[model samples]
Target: MRNWEDIGYLQIGTSRQRQAHAAFERLGILATLNAFGPVLAGTIPLNIDLPSSDLDLICEVPQLALADFQLLLRQHYGHLPRFSLQETMVRGCPSVVGGFEAEGFAWEVFGQPQPTRAQHAVRHLLVEYAVLEAGGEAWRQAVLTLKRQGLKTEPAFAQLLQLPGDPYAALLTLENLTSAELRQRLPPLRP
Candidate 1:
């Protein structure tokens, strides 16, 4: 599916993705955060996750519903291992973050006063997915190798692409390009 909202595709994905699907099902994470419009983002969904990668769930939580959202998370997930909930600002927007470990994966639930699709994490995921699809397996392996060597997803891509300045923002610059344009702009694939 082009949209990452429906996670059914994960069931047929890589082994780690299948495991993630099972964990999500076991915890009912998306259902638990349904009211907030949760969308799974990050490396795991893209099949480039490191062994230590955590599940990143992004949600839309309006300011008025902040308390209820926090309550719901605490009520449902607080008893999970290492449960912690807090409020902070991300890109100047107020955000609620909760974390817990379940079924062998660390789960991070993030809520912002904006649409999940509009959040940077989801946007980055979409762009990164496009890059991976166009770059083929070699590019994917390069990104994974960089990640294993201690780089975050964005920086790994940035380093391979020779992108300058803030890797996060640089990646976004390629967000709207067509696949053809991306292929043209991307450096030749390396072995």
Candidate 2:
């Protein structure tokens, strides 16, 4: 079989992202989650979804009554399809993790401590966006092909695509590259 991937935006629209964030705001989940630190990181925000991608969020829960915050999320939004908010851990600290749907997007939020959160960069999403901006459909599909073939992380995708740097480093540096530049960056596939 040949390399298969996504050529265009996923069927979901950008509005879904706003709606989810809005729901977080309207429900005060944003502010509540923010007490620890706030961020939405994952395939959804990056707009790079596989056929089965779900939303992932990173948050840090404060030691002060984290249980109360998590409970609030579930009590307020649990009615949503597949909602399952619960206390969880990230890098050995406490967090809340679960999924909920809003305006047609499937979302998963993970609350993590500030220090642990710092190590998780959303730049991968930025890199994907930059690649999308610079290289358009072909680059996206190529990356998706790697993803579809079970190369989940960006670095693995970049490595398989023969990109010039560490998968992580290359993506951070790949912004504004043209289609030709992208093609140029790709070394010939090994036999």
Candidate 3:
């Protein structure tokens, strides 16, 4: 299983880079859900404004066979992005990819071999209902780890953090994802 830390380039942060990453991720999530069904377990994990490099989604996909999953993805997205899948350190896990494609957020997936363990431990910390409230420790750990491996964190995320009050608190203040529009995710609030 290859550790993301070993992948290295993940830490590179920039506005252009973050936008690419997010688009790739959105595609992956939509592809997976479209193929398999509703996600049984998953998290948006990150919402704060930073020059994000990749969007992260942690989920349990129990019923779908890998080949079928790939086929469905290809049909929907047209082709798979240039991504290399890595075997995870967790046993029984196959591989995860940091891939980019047109029309969606850049995404990374960690298919847990030991679903129970990863779900309870890493996923809990990364995807709890109050994930935004988890503070900077875990995120800092991820940032540092990626840096050690030569990756970059998004710059906008850092800029948001420097703002007064809780930077992401504004998100919590929203009653609905769409205050008026039927299907729209708002732009990140300026601090």
Pick by lDDT: which candidate is best? 1
Q: What TM-score fits each model?
A: 0.97, 0.59, 0.39
Q: lDDT by residue for model 3 over 1-191, one digit each (tens)?
A: 21321212223544544554455455545455543232222222333224333444444445345555444444554455754454444434553333443454445554443343344324333222232333334544443454445433332223323323542333233322232331133224332
Which ranges in model 3 have alpha carbons more than 4 Å from their true place? 1-44, 48-52, 78-89, 96-98, 112-191
Candidate 3 local distance difference test against the native: 0.38
Which scores higher on TM-score, 1 or 2? 1
Per-candidate local distance difference test:
0.91, 0.59, 0.38
Q: Could you tell me how far off, in angstroms, the CA of residue 61 lies in candidate 3 after the best superposition?
A: 2.9
Q: Write the per-residue lDDT of candidate 2 for residues 21-64, one digit (tens) a residue.
A: 55555555555555545555556555556757765655555567
Give the lDDT ranking, best first. 1, 2, 3
- Point out the worst 10-residue segment of candidate 3 by lDDT: 1-10
